[model samples]
Target: MSSNAHSFYYGGKFLSKVTDLVRSEIEPIIAARGDEFVDIEYVKEKSQNYLRIYVDKDQPGGIDIDEIAALSEEVSEKLDSLEPDPLPDPYVLELSSPGVERPIKNAKDWEKANGEYIHVGLYQKIDGKKMFEGTLKSYNDEEIELEIKIKTRRKTLTIPRKLIANARFAIEF
Candidate 1:
């Protein structure tokens, strides 16, 4: 088999295993620190692999750099002792807060996003629109209400929850 095909099947599976193991190792440490574990990804870019971890405080305000540094130290110590190491040597490990364009992954994200500008992706077109960027006024089990701009004018659009594929905090401009 060609290298591309071999990688297409095995590389991703191996990468997932690495990411999962890393998450299992670090998530408890993060939770014990009273923070939310947003996400973890292990990927290769330009011949180097990156183990990026996104975390946030459960309370109001962004997580501080000092806290992130301490957590990173703790996480490094834990991963260092893993019997079967999953990470590749020379991989870049990053621990930080999810910044301006963070994905909305849980209930707290939704609540924090209320009245904030965001990008919404849909599974199919809703009135010829498969996506929207607007102020998220509110959301519930059934749908979300967004105030969007139509040229100079603005209107509130009700989008069904079932149609949403992804939602994320976004910057306007």
Candidate 2:
């Protein structure tokens, strides 16, 4: 076991800062193009480092390939031109659309996911269960209302937004 597991490492902190800078720099460009850049996540596994960008559009499912390619090229150029340079090491940069099972992270995400089947994990149990799989009826910044069909009746359950541990599109065949 590593004794440094619980400690904050400088390299990790620096990487986080770099990712933040990249996210901030790219958000405006994406927004101006009438799209949203969801998240900038750094993945370090084994001996490889990956900078993954998740983006979304108003329509459901994945975004267009041209949009992804364009954003990737633009971001690459900007990052390469940074004065002090954000990243210290070589890494693989991947820009792509968030797919069907994409996570619902914010109010806009939840709103966009409305009317779709979703699986949600709650921080606390509700009706003896901490998980729910149902159709998202509606959602705002404060709460999400899911319509769960049980028997012959449909029930709408209101869940506080912050109580959601995780949520993602539930694919049904």
- Candidate with top lDDT is 1
Writing each residue's lDDT as its tens digit, candidate 1 over 1-173 gives: 00111111232344335666677778899999998899887767798877888999866777999999999999989878876566536778889888879898678889989999999999999889999999999999889999999999999999998899889999999
Off by over 4 Å in 1: 1-17, 88-90
**lDDT (tens digit, per residue) of candidate 2 on 1-173:** 00111222242354325566677778888888778877677667688877888887876555799988988898888778865656667888888877778887777777778899998999999888899888999888788899987777989999998888889888854
Clashing pairs in 1: none
Off by over 4 Å in 2: 1-17, 59-62, 149-155
How many residue pairs clash per model? 0, 0
Q: Give the TM-score of candidate 1.
A: 0.81
Task: Highest TM-score: give the candidate number.
Answer: 1
Give model 1 RMSD, 1 decimal: 5.3
Candidate 2: the clashing residue pairs are: none
Give lDDT: candidate 2, residue 154.
85
